[model samples]
Target: MSLGDDHGYGDSARTDASGEYGGTGTTRTRLPESGPYGGARRGRSSSRSLVTVVGVVVLLIAAIAFANRGDGDSGGAPDTADKPDTAPTAASGTDPVKSSTAGVPTGYSQSEQGAQSAATNYAVALGSTGMFRKADRHALLDALFTRDAAARLKGPMDQAYSTGFLDSMGLDENGDPPEGSTFVSRVSPMGTTVEEYTDTTAKVAVWYVGLIGMSGERSTDPVTSTWKTWTFDLSWTDGDWKIVEDAQTDGPAPVPGDDRAATSDEISKAIEEYGGFTYAR
Candidate 1:
């Protein structure tokens, strides 16, 4: 797994110990070898959209099933014509932690909600601008992953974020953008689901949208949006959840809205002004 800027987004076509992001219909098993930005090579953008639609349908069915078993009572008959607005069915009444370890959220509960929280927070951290730097990246992985997983991933990850990759992103050897340039790479979790759960282990999938690129007049790689589902296999270790394994797949994206894309300056300013959240489910 590489800590490079191009690691998490599904734009790549290659896979490694680091997670892979697939396109709409096809699975991207690895990072792209084409260039530093991993420009989209898949000719099937429409097919990828269809796959996202199908994935959404599957998630809806699962959500319905889960809702039916709430409070130990069978949910009432389905009302297709008068379906309620989409919203979270269960609320744990728990607030997110106000503290963090090395800028990563901690203190998750031992329930499914906690698992989802851990996955979403981890997604954000893994997708941040900090991943481009070796020192920050190492600290992040150490904080989020189990000791064994971190140890196994360190070497491959270091290799992935080699000098060549950083140079490709127009960053200096230290992974810093040129003066007056802002490198933006951030992940925003839209929703989360618990795929599997037990007392000690949990599998959670975070549906998120990410922004990646350098925002500056001299920048060759411009910021762009990507939708993906990041699945994390977590262990309840010590007093917090830690990742043992993780993977990314193409999105469960909804149809695009009529919103216009923001300008580079606007994106850069927003990134600087806004702080990330400690997401809770």
Candidate 2:
């Protein structure tokens, strides 16, 4: 295929239909929610990388549990005040961190510690490798966010995963690489602060850096980029850090440093070799 073969999602579906996640070949499974599921799902961004912060709807949807995310530096935040110029990571938790993730709270609590833990974990889930998989997308969405928001967000996501977009990353149709590539997408939370909170309503921001691209392959966009600190104005909803509405501006972006780029083999191996974690505030 030529470099600019217009593989954009506007083109036809090239379902690799293979039996892998990040490997070559398209694959589709008949979920219980199958049939005519796709046509309606076409409008969402369809991005398999870290889901981009799409819009403001996330604000209302994620407001259920912000009450306990702890307040800002002085202990609580006034949602309307001019926020800090920038937020750095936090010190260790002074409060307890308990989370009952899915039936099992898993020790998640509702204090500054709890909020931090929740934010960290949610950020990881929100910024995971699963965002790319069609089969796993809904589950991750349902798990981390409110159902209402998930419903509306899905279609836009599908569209975002257009063929041209995937090709741009040197992948075939299903957001995967040939035999020797590693598509890497990860989000590391530098720290988080609850800008505002009131019982069932709260606003939290997670500042982070994400890594996206084919680590080592025939890719022009190496699996390397340093975006500005990403902030999520998340809400506490349906028992999780559901991002109701969020926005991002450029960095506390660090100056370009002297870290050597990993070789394609190193990147691919690392992608497969390294495991991801569920972050908490």
Candidate 3:
């Protein structure tokens, strides 16, 4: 499964995602520039109006570019990585994958189990709320993505968290609470497997789900769920599956059940009142 196949907004196609920078549509019209002396005045007015439109377009382009800059990269379906220098030398490199509930990884490794462990754990971290905060986002990319990719991602990711994005989700321009609303964005890994592996690199597939959107009465689209498979093209840069690139797309999704959806208030309270988990497998 490719990373683009993910289920949440992170998913390339199947998920419902909107970044703060760009409004959902992309169509645009050009402004009139010819002078209107008789038509001169008319022309000037048209030009000014068009100029204003151009300005909005420029801002939109910049915003979308910034907001959508994330880790998912492409290099075809995951293939095996380069060979390691030493023969499985008594299980070296980083500590074992740490766990919180049962599937989360605190820190993981490169062994078979370790690969799966790392993928699952990393998925949770990559999909969590931390990816939105500057300090937390930095901590996560450094901890999860490949060093080079992480460096490229830092600034763009920050810009993507624009005030407009917050407003779209019914959040304050800073993604903080408005006294009553709660923001909900989370990921939970279900299973994992090493799609590609070698001593120097490993491609791990993490199948999981995510919950997103505003959590209050004001939200038009309340929280929703999606399933996706995120494939990581990791290089053993330092140690671990330091993601060089990744991609996402829709499920492997199961058909929907006939269950009643939660109320906006219920969802809000759950998000505001509840906390997320620390995973390990």
Candidate 4:
């Protein structure tokens, strides 16, 4: 996926696939009131029913008693002797970066958690409204990318955010929406993964849902959502993680839900009122 496909941040020539971001009835069987098996079978069935009811009651009582036990004072805690040493997954409990460079998060730790955090934050920055503006976009790239990468990408990135491209998205040549219209290009990362990592370099992926387009009564390009996975190759340099390369792929998008599309007014109001998050793994 190109950045333009989600945020209008990349070359518009590379249009990605716009695929359609592609119940139980219970029945009860009743026992026969009468059958050829006779009254003896009926008596046995009644006994079995009584036994099942009694067993259920006993189990319920036992469960309640177990739940009410003391917390290991009298050896009443649940048996955890065979529990595994490591958790299958867990959070690192690190707070997101409180400081940023040119509005991009910086100063991540040297751990896997930090790598994931950096990747997620980079995805958000690369997919933000600032990326559509020349000066702000250059600043963002300089702050988030390594020096070499930024130099190599400067010309291409400028070309990608061209005036013609901005015009196609209902924006003026400067990447600003017309008066009374709101241009929305925001990325919210759902989760992050460190696909590969080392002390000096790491490859991370962030799965995210993005909102893009112009929101206004007169807007032809209404705001819409796209799901994508953004992967970044990062290097630990100058005591911070900086992106060396970045790429995006069309999602593992979920089936569309039944919710009605919100009105332009509602969309504009929501964007204005709700702030974005400082994401962490």
Error of 3 at 229 (Å): 1.1
On lDDT, the candidate that comes out on top is: 1
The Cα local distance difference test for each model comes to 0.69, 0.47, 0.52, 0.65
Could you tell me how far off, in angstroms, the CA of residue 239 lies in candidate 3 after the best superposition?
3.7
Weakest 10 consecutive residues of candidate 4 by summed lDDT: 20-29
Q: What lDDT score is found at residue 187 in candidate 2? A: 65
- The candidate that wins on TM-score is 1
Ranking of predictions according to TM-score: 1, 4, 3, 2
Off by over 4 Å in 3: 1-106, 272-281
- Please tell me which model should have the higher lDDT, number 1 or number 3: 1
What is the Cα-based TM-score of model 1?
0.74
Superposed Cα deviation of residue 247, candidate 2 (Å): 2.1
**Which pairs clash (backbone N, Cα, C closer than 3 Å) in model 4?**
none
Model 3 clash tally, residue pairs: 28
Evaluate residue 262 in candidate 3 and report its C-alpha lDDT on the 0 to 100 scale: 87
TM-score of 2: 0.60
Model 4, range 1-281, lDDT digits (tens) per residue? 12444333322222111110000111111111111000210112235556678779999999999999775587656688987543224456678576889977788888778888888888778677886788887898688877766655556556555676668767688878899999887888878777789999998878888777778999987777777777777889998898766656667776554456899999999999998866665
Candidate 2: segments with Cα more than 4 A from true spot = 1-108
**Candidate 4: residue 213 lDDT (0-100):** 71
RMSD vs true structure, all candidates: 8.6, 15.1, 19.7, 17.9
Per-residue C-alpha lDDT of model 1 across residues 1-281, encoded as one tens digit per residue: 22222434224433334344322321122342433223342223345567678889999999998987667446676668876434394545687565688798888888888888888888888877776788987898789888766655555556656687778777787889999999887788888888889989998888877777789887787886666677888899978898877766666656554355687788889989998887888
